[model samples]
Target: MTSKTIASSEPSIIESIDQLFLRFIVGKNKIYKEEEYNDGLSEAEQDDKELGLPAAEEKSGWNQRILLEVEKDRVKRVEADKRLKDKRNALLMRYFQQSLLKVVNDKLENSESVISDQLQLRENTVELLKKLLAGEPRYSVLASLLELNPGTRNRLLSLVSSEDFMKALGRDPRNVRDIQTAIGMIGTDVLRFLVPAILFKYRINAYSHHNTLFAKKLWRYEMTLGQTCTALMHDINYRRPYEGMLLSAMVNFAYVASYQQYLSSFEVVRTACLDQAREKGEKNRHDFFYDIKTDSASLQALLVSQADLKLSLALSEKLFQKSFPHLVNALKEEVEGLAYEERTTVGKILFKAVRFAKYDQLRSSRLFKPEWQDDYLADSYIEQDVFKNLLRQELFRFKPTWS
Candidate 1:
């Protein structure tokens, strides 16, 4: 009875349901149309136009607002990517530092004592002599004569007893004192040849037995450079091939020693990297391993001095003095006052040889070749065709002996 006359603003139940459905449809259509309109305008323009702004103002505001937001988002994304890259690089550097420290610490802990060091030195010398004498009939005969036989009274007696030994030494046993004197003289002369060969072999062994990857890389580089240098000197008819060989071998050995010293200062290196990152920014941080500033002259001096001393101790004083009378003096003069031209020549040859060897190693090992940037060697040296053929010959002969 209360609803007998329906008000204009109110409706019956069925009419109310139909009105609700119609409103729902109308709302959905309006939303769809608004979406279509919004698709044609920028977000800023859509909002401004919906709020009843003029078309010109909407267009102008749209460009500025949208561009600002896009620029802000782009900046944020770039910063995020940079942070991610820096974090990854830092982690990688930390891992390398840790690994290097472990290697250096292990080497230090297991370093041999003085007596053991002497024994190892003697053993290396003996092994080098054996290798030097292994394949040659004449050298083998001389080596046999040099060996002490308990069956005989001494080395002299052993040599006198053997016909081949005396023959190789170009001595007659008819005069025992003369034979002894001749053997002494021959031994002294032979030592000149033997010493350099022995030192070279020792260097090769030292490089081969290194426990680290970087050491191993240095070893390969040394081998390639030494061989190439020696061959180049020979090809150029250099009067001092032995000097060239000794110098090349010493350069690499000294570098390795210096690098080891650097590695021993791993804590300093890590701190330096951190400081560099903080001060110069992460992108400008120094690569500690590759960026080590080795004093070439100092390294050369140290190596040459040690070599002179060691060779004197290892060989008979008379033999060493007679054979290498000016070795120390010559080395001192060359290393101390090395001319720019001379340094450039040697450095260039070595650089080219090392580069070639690196590429060869990479190709042979099926490893990825990184972009070969100009490193320390390149900084100090320029490539030339001075020893191109010689380098090729040496590389051809110098097969990879490393695992």
Candidate 2:
């Protein structure tokens, strides 16, 4: 494929209100490999992907080690900038986010990012998983899971067979002699939670390695975000709590996919500019540097593209509407931080809920910024008292047990 080209003139960039928060959400997942999204690709576009690039310049092994290690070591000094801590730390946070994703992208290229070597999904698995989330019957869901992915079947069986899992369910493991018995005891309500929990865990959680720094933290944030959203929605529509969780999952999935696309797009642009510079015998990559991360005209277009999430998620938008009708527009408006009075009921709740989730996450990482925490405009929607009450919850402060 031919390389992607940048516009001759810079495009006008619209800055979103959530820009500060999204900079912290950039962890890796290879949404490009999902297949459904890549249909009808031009041959040239395929070539571009086959040649999809990395941003950092190649260096000698020892030199590279020193470069990366030196950058890693800079965290101390960056964090120590007491006066400029918020801004400088925010920059380092963005670098850290990209570095975490780079680690995942590298592992994916080497075929090492799969959750488990033996785990696999079927061609119709997405459809079936959607049905499963929509509260299909346990027998049908299990049968579909068994027929579609033996890896899932084996794993589910192993989970149900575990002493701790069964003990949590208030069952004696000795009484649950087999998968059939365990499934029988668990009932459909529990199965709905477990089955979707399993798929949802894999579908959107993008950590590629156990040792990676943000692997568990990002996963934990995603879970807590969804849970926090679900709890907030439940306060209003108590009957639709499960649907609320599923909707949050869709948002988180889109969020991750958009980040991946932005990184890929940045690489394509940076590679093209660098290639042209090399042909001209230019030694520096300064031309494209200003257009990407920090200084850019079309900041959203050049960096994280919040616009992409308005498109189809891995699951159907129709499915999301059936559960949460106002949610679709809320995701779009939340990016811009629409005024609370202007937001729909769901939007008002979701916007605050998501911000709260991120606030909780950053606090857990000890990266909380007083600027966001002290914002009067944000507190105006959900008063400071309510925000404090929500943050005081155990789920907001600690990682979920599943994580």
Candidate 3:
């Protein structure tokens, strides 16, 4: 008789998420220098040069920085064609504007700082925002980019730094060089936990229908999905992820916007569900929809919704093409090169990843009340037992944000 063959199973979903989180956890990505450095200049100088900025002429105790101010004096008057077409996105943007307004107003003025609508950002943080918008300092993408290990601060300063990463956002590396030679300029409060929270008031006015400022966190969450989809796309097609990444960010954002009002409406359900689920076993619980993220049907329907995607694509082009021309064009070229089926598959993967991220976030916050239902496991793409186990594994991971 021929020897029987048995295939070993893959990691569960819980395991995969755990694996991914650990893979991307802060400081896990270490910079590996392929060549030895012999330049007499210190590591700090080396880093500055790597970012395409001029190193200090002489070692001064204080680093000379070219401060770039955020343009608040003039109204950002984008033309009608140049306007963000997504009314929801426009609404969310108003959230950013109001949030900004709270910190900056014409009535109150000061030389040392800029505060509007009672929101006070450190003078340095405002500078950091300028660098981020200008794509300068390279590390601006990762916020403060605080590194645990000085010896090896991720692949480049931190996981999200480096010109290549930001280039994926359609920005020019050249623009970064002219802004400021000095790097690591901001290193205090905002870096630790401010920028996102700093702009927000603890007691927000309930006036606007789109008052909730959860969109920032949603951006962070969707970016993770877009990025992970980029990785998965590369795994399938073996092409660089620039196109997939940019396109995915736009798609993910639109889908997230679809849930804009839902995000707020879910709170009442969440509170009720939490109370109902208390002291009850899974088998004994009543059925209830606890999340405003809506059903999978809406997600699947989004893929076929041309109107939804077109508005988003148009807005994305209008909003970013000026600043990130290269990144946007890269996606166009890549979409042409890739097969339609492949791009669709990438979109599907992104949808799946965002659902996973949302599930994990909700579960972490104790709002994922229907714990008994593992609907994602039933998706046709992950039908195999190996994939099923992978889904199971994701639940074991710890929550880093939104907890």
Candidate 4:
């Protein structure tokens, strides 16, 4: 595809906002590939792909690494500021409610210029002081207190929503609500939360070919866990229609991928596993997977005797090895000395549960009518490709990852 020239006269703010808008529109899956969004494609060039142009080229490894570093540094600063949330909120309140905080206002006004200098407020401090004197509610008032312009606010919020930032905060991104709440709070602070919220949404829960949830939300979420995984494995989604088999397999791999990072309190994988076990009438997932330190032969014997329980354990191990071999090695070190039979059983069960969670491409049962068969066969290759292409496109962006 030919590259379009960005208008040189365009204001930097507009250019940045356009760039941010393009990133949001693409909804690039960062969990699979982090550098795809930072390639600096012009908005129009990206939009042209909607007209059937080829996808944009991948950025160089050096550029990708540099982009990742910049993102990391910005996230680090945002996280460091998070520890002082009470202080930041207080500062924000004081920055907008000087009339209510006369003592604070006086102190800030009389304080050394170096204090303002240290915070980089400089001349903005006077405007902030004036806004505070107007006496507005903190959250509502702060929404209008644009210390940074819209573009800068958006960029900063994106940094706040980065993977590194979430990791530093010890935030687990299992539930949509938790991710939404965190991003919402940060974004509502007159610092443009939309981009940050979108970024967080992508990270906490991405679509995958195997997630029933992902299949459910195909259109709304856009990128399947499979697509994300493929992007990570293949570097980008540049391959043509007939060349998607590798991408399909990568999607499958991501479905069973293991989690090694420190997850927050609200991950759904644990809950989903427990729910599946309960539905299947299995007693004690912990007993099936966990190794008891106490010398309890009876507990060990009971674990071995149960057929379904043993199967579940075996499934879990096999699936973990497939999805995340790296994680399996780490996990093995943590729970050593489990009986071979017990391990096999647990891996089997876990694999079955994960398999059932896969996305279903064909939502409706197959139509077996003679007329339907004739209609399907009459379509030309281009028409068939277009129909299948549209279906995949719609499926990729659906909501809740499943329905």
The candidate scoring highest on lDDT is 2
lDDT of 3 at 384: 46
Instruction: Give the alpha carbon lDDT tens digit for every residue of 1-403 in model 2.
Output: 0011256353211122244334433322222222322222453345434543222454444455444677655644544553264465446446534544444334323221221221123335545555655555567555655556554555567776678876777765544334545566665555544554555565443454321333354456656666666566655764444444555655655444433433344555555555766778755333433343421122233224433444333233434555445666666566445666788766676666666666676566444545545553344356776666566665533221221
List residue ranges in candidate 2 displaced over 4 A: 1-17, 26-123, 133-138, 149-152, 173-182, 204-211, 258-303, 311-338, 370-380, 384-389, 396-403
For 170-228, candidate 3 gives per-residue lDDT tens digits of 43333222111213322221122222222221212223334233333344444444444
Q: What ranges in model 4 sit over 4 Å off?
A: 1-7, 11-87, 90-393, 397-403
Q: Cα deviation in Å at residue 212, candidate 4?
A: 16
- Candidate rank order under TM-score: 2, 1, 3, 4
> Candidate 3: where is the Cα deviation over 4 Å?
1-213, 242-245, 252-310, 317-343, 369-373, 383-403
Stretch of 10 with least lDDT, candidate 4:
257-266
Cα-lDDT of candidate 1: 0.40
- Candidate number achieving the greatest TM-score relative to the actual structure: 2
Model 4, range 1-403, lDDT digits (tens) per residue? 0012366654333223223322332332322222444433554465455433333353444343334688667756765664465365445334323322232223223223312321222343324323432233354444344333343335444545566544544543322323234444443322221222232233323453223233233223223333322222232232221112122222222111111011211123344445665778766443331321111122122222221222222333443345334334323421342322444422222221111112222222121222333233222111344334434544343121111
Please give the distance, in angstroms, between residue 18's alpha carbon in candidate 4 and its true position after superposition. 6.1
Write one digit per residue (lDDT tens) for candidate 1, span 193-244: 3244334443334452223444444455555555565555555575444343
lDDT of 3 at 150: 23
lDDT of each: 0.40, 0.48, 0.36, 0.31
Task: Mark the 10 consecutive residues where model 2 has the least summed lDDT.
Answer: 110-119
Best of the two (1, 4) by TM-score: 1
| Count of steric clashes across candidates, in order | 0, 3, 25, 56
lDDT for model 2, on a 0 to 1 scale? 0.48
Candidate 1: where are CA atoms >4 Å away? 1-142, 145-210, 239-244, 253-322, 325-334, 341-383, 394-403
Please give the TM-score that candidate 1 achieves against the real structure.
Answer: 0.33
